[model samples]
Target chain A: MIHALRISLAIIALSLLASCTPTTGTKIAVNQSEISKIKSIGVLVKKDEDFSVRLSREEMSNTGAAFGLIGVGIEAAVRRSSDKDKEEQIKPSLGNFDPQAPLTERLRFHLQEGAIATSEVTDGGEKTAADAILEVTVRQWGLRRCPGPAPEVVQAGFNVNGKLYRASGHATVWEREELYLNGDCRPWSMFRSEELANDILPRALDALATKLVYEILYP
Target chain B: MKRLIRHFIFALALGLVLSACVFSNANVNLAYKPVEGSKSPLSTVKPLKIALVVEDQRPIAERESIGNKRNGYGSVTAQVKSNSDVLTVFSDALKTELGNNGHTVVADKEPLYDVMLRVQLKRYWTDSVIHFWDVELVGTINSDFVLGKRDGDKPILSQPGQGTFRESRQFVTDSAYENVLNGALSEFVRNFSRDPNIIKALQQAGQTATPM
Candidate 1:
């Protein structure tokens, strides 16, 4: 009888385990109807903001001097400052911009391109066009620190916040932040910085496109 | 033998529970005009195609879960949902509102359509203490004109919203999801339909109506 009871319970348990299934279903995040309406109502990019070109007398005179003496150092710093200014131009005083790769591409809205120009005269004979002008007043733009730790774990003799420390007796240098001669920030190089900026500008444009679409369609 | 059997059962149950919670933090749902009325312009216009892209990296399942928790006034759970889902719902609600007002609606995959809508959900973060999801939704409309156009066409409309949703609510209570979606849609549609060019186009089409 004991053996029989054990077998019965085993069968019941097996069946229950087999029946277990993950929760699943099709949830339409955005249905067909909604997609259609937006497509029909085209979105326009906003006008680019007027950036006041600011330069110190020394910096202005150097036009070539900063690049000449510092090599790429001065250029990088100026670029960073200019980038900050450009970032502000894209932000809106109120509301928000969309942040998606695909949707942004579809709408062709971009920050670098600025908001859609609503005031531009269309070919149509109508005096006032566009149902409502979407004015995107940018508040914040640019690369902000993405928080969290490194994706991988690093260990050495002594564990110090994912860094490894070596004793004085060690012959070879340990690959660690404190042990490294240079800091986390890369040495300023114009060639490399320009390359990076090229990549970033397009991405910013992509993000801009996303933001522009959201403002127009949802405005 | 008894011990072995009990052990097996416990292990099985444990596995099932783990899988259930793997991506259990979200939900999604659609909200349109509760009933058709004068505001439904989409009923007259042919539906177009639009694609909604959610910004966050979460799987589609969690995104849907977040969307399902919305209400007319917008609920806390709805806000707790992901940013992408929130934008998805808002854009759809806006479209529905536009449709109700007599604009034709279509699918995003379809070509040769009148308008194309692209929406992006951005900056979605949740505050566990208060149980709220802070989000910004960005929307844009794209239109192409083959003739009499400048610079190869451009976007027709762009809009964005910064809104907040509470984390919890009574089972029967309405939340911010509904309120924001409804409000945003109303604003977008009213402005879209009132455009003089759009109105003129529609009027011209109406006048030229001959058996197609």
Candidate 2:
């Protein structure tokens, strides 16, 4: 009987630990390039509604001082996991592209380095004196917590859809949609008010921009 | 049961202390002025009398602090907010930069100018994130400029420019995010003035202007 009880307690502890862990989503893929022959590119970043951090029902229910120490430990674990992910997944793929700049600036900076002149195109009506126009639409651009009843994970990333058009004819030459997630898991990791305006979001954005730039320049 | 209570209290105290130590509220102001250019590119040509109009349509230029919101016991995270008049300050900065560039900048609705420069602020914000002991401030601004002869006149040059400035500094007591914003504004103005299209538009407007 005592052995059975011990096993039950061990299982409970393990389950609790699992519930505190963070979870990550899949990495984005680089699509075929369409910007090779284009000498000048006009970038347009469409305005979207503000994005906020979203929490799941599980995160909402798992509250109170009883789980306080465990929550802190879980947060620390999540941070460590995020750092590890950054080192292993993000840095290796992105290489030298910096995440500090906005998507438009980064694109311009990278394209300019490759001898391609870049101009910003605002409002659809303005004349874009470039060979092609790159229209960027940000569907989701913030941090999101995994909606779950199991392992806890938070993702900081963006979902972007891009279309490149030939300016002379205004015809779409290339279209791609990408979702990049940088997340970490911890058991019972229900942090109520974590700041999402951090390096991770920018890094995720940088990753997306890098992938797009790669496809544009090399493809 | 007593031990559980003790642990809970300890955790709560720890969480509160962590939140208190890290969270802050700062009011950022972009107070930098642009230096006048000694050799304006438009020096040889007749200085075009231009109307400078700034439009700021952003809803709010501030990110509010997210205080400790307890989900369950010790799961509290703190967030800092920095608020400022981002649009007004940026317009002032741009005007100073234009005047420094040796352009006659007027703020009138009368159609009495050679060309009109309409600048619209699309986005301006500072994203401040705490990483370990340092706070990273990423300042970004996007503005659209339309240079036309009058309100309904065909635009000579219509372009949008964006600037991103980043700074990571040790979390200090004083407000340093303002410097990052100012740096971004300065870069924006500098880039705008040097844009090949913008320079060309000014020169062309000077050559085509009806003599007063």
Question: Which candidate number has the best lDDT?
Answer: 2
Query: Candidate 1, residue A167: CA error in Å?
Result: 86
DockQ, model 2, C-alpha based: 0.05
> In candidate 2, what are the lDDT values of residues A1-219, reduced to their tens digit?
999999999977765554311111112222334455688989877646344333332133323224455554455455545544433433333334333247888777766876889898885624888988877777755444432234445555566677777888887776655444443333223322232234444555655665565445432
- Model 1 lDDT at residue A123: 25
Residues A1-219 of candidate 1: C-alpha lDDT, one tens digit per residue: 999999999977765554312111111122223333322222222222322112121122223332344533455466557645533543332123232222234343332233433233222213434332222222222232111122211110000011111112212111111000000112122112333234433443443334333333322
The most accurate candidate by DockQ is 2
DockQ for the candidates, in order: 0.02, 0.05
Candidate lDDT values, in order? 0.32, 0.56
For the candidates in turn, chain A alone yields TM-scores of: 0.27, 0.55
Residues forming the 10-long window of minimal summed lDDT in candidate 1 chain A: A155-164
Say which candidate scores most in TM-score.
2
TM-score of chain A of 1: 0.27
TM-score of chain B of each: 0.36, 0.72
